[model samples]
Target: MKKTRNTQKQDYVIDILTNAKHTMSVEAILKAMPIKVNKTTVYRILERFAEKGKVHFVTGEDGKAYYALCNDCNVKHEMHNHIHFQCKSCKKVTCLPYEIEVPELKDFEVQETQFLMIGICDMCIS
Candidate 1:
């Protein structure tokens, strides 16, 4: 497979995700960017990054898709295999270190698993 070079927009998006404290929606990412970028362009870049395994999205408690950079994700293997936790109060989504293995069924194949836990975050509890 031929590797495609990342465009300027893609790089910028990756940088934003890398530095973000928590998962961000497309609109949030756009607003946080220093320079202006088209909404469509940002979405496209995110989609491409997701396909390449550089980033992944989780549905937050707000019913919005939140994108996050995979800690050690690369072109070859992009799966971080971590649990996603969304705070019920603040609606902040965080990646947890707990890894859960999916049970294989006799006649079914499990391609991927998206695990999520919704609860009050540490800050919210205090």
Candidate 2:
């Protein structure tokens, strides 16, 4: 398959984030990118990543959020019932759904769920 420039950027972002030790802000992403892209373009790419279950988001204490990769095996993460970790110290957000479960409520039929966890990451605390 032919790779589009946007796809290439997306892949670059993913790889960079995967190896990164801290959450990447928009400025960080833009500065690290080899290609010239505006803030809107970056946000658009993130939105696509979120929709595809490739990334998850979290708001930090500063009210600025970060995105992390969503790892799943058999079941695709349908934005349904998952937990994300936001370390207070390092400010890195990590997706950890094992600690959380889908809410069981008879009153409502859930279509989409996003569970997020915020706390001190190991790297941050140690």
Candidate 3:
């Protein structure tokens, strides 16, 4: 058996995602990174990770994309039907533990689903 090597950029992105407490935008990710990287490169890496089920993202009402790790997904299956909570006050996005089963569509295959709630979070309320 052989293992694939992760690029330095990918490793850095993974480290950032793993340590992040809330979903982060591309700008936020770039600011948190130790070294500056091209915006396109960062987005590309994030897109790859999302496709691989390593990370997931939700677009904010403001039209910015926020990303978080998919703790339940694996290489064989991509578990991404988890709920997302976005704090209205702080504008922070958090991945909720709640997972829901998607209902089937007639003559159609569902590839992805997004269940997001926007409101004041506990931290914001306090």
Candidate 4:
């Protein structure tokens, strides 16, 4: 696989996501960027990251897409079966460490699975 050159903006975006340690929306990512970057550019960067298996996205409870860095994904395969937790109070989305077993089906092949748990987080509970 050909590795694409990352621009300054792309590096900045990756930094934001890496430091965040949680899922963030496009608007949030734009706000976190120190330099001025257009929305289209951010979207394109995220698309490239997804293609390279560096990042993954999930739809939040609010119907907005949230992005986060991939833990064990690569260009050949992108498999995510871990749990994603969303706090109802804070509306924060985070990738949980626990991985659930994907059940086998007799006549079907499951390509992807997303397990989302909606509840209050530790901060909110305290």
- The alpha-carbon RMSD values of the candidates against the true structure, listed in the order shown, are 4.3, 3.1, 3.5, 3.8
TM-scores across all candidates?
0.82, 0.69, 0.87, 0.84
Candidate 1 — what's its lDDT? 0.79
- Which has the greatest TM-score? 3
User: CA lDDT of each candidate?
Assistant: 0.79, 0.69, 0.83, 0.84
Q: Give a tens-digit lDDT track for model 2, residues 12-126.
A: 7888678765567776788888888878888898888878787766665667657666645335456434566677676666655464556668988776665556687787677
Candidate 4, 11-111: lDDT as tens digits: 98889999996899999999999988899999999999988778888788999889998855532335576788999999999988887777778999776
| CA shift of 10, model 4, Å | 0.9
Residue 64 of model 1, lDDT score: 83
In order of listing, the candidates' clash counts read 0, 3, 0, 0
Identify the runs in model 4 with alpha carbons over 4 angstroms from their true place: 1-6, 72-77, 104-109
Ranking by TM-score: 3, 4, 1, 2
Q: How would you encode candidate 1's per-residue C-alpha lDDT over 32-59 as one tens digit per residue?
A: 8777888888888988878777888887
Clashing residue pairs, candidate 3?
Answer: none
Q: In what order do the candidates fall by lDDT, top score first? A: 4, 3, 1, 2
**Considering lDDT, which of the candidate structures 2 and 3 is the better prediction for this target?**
3
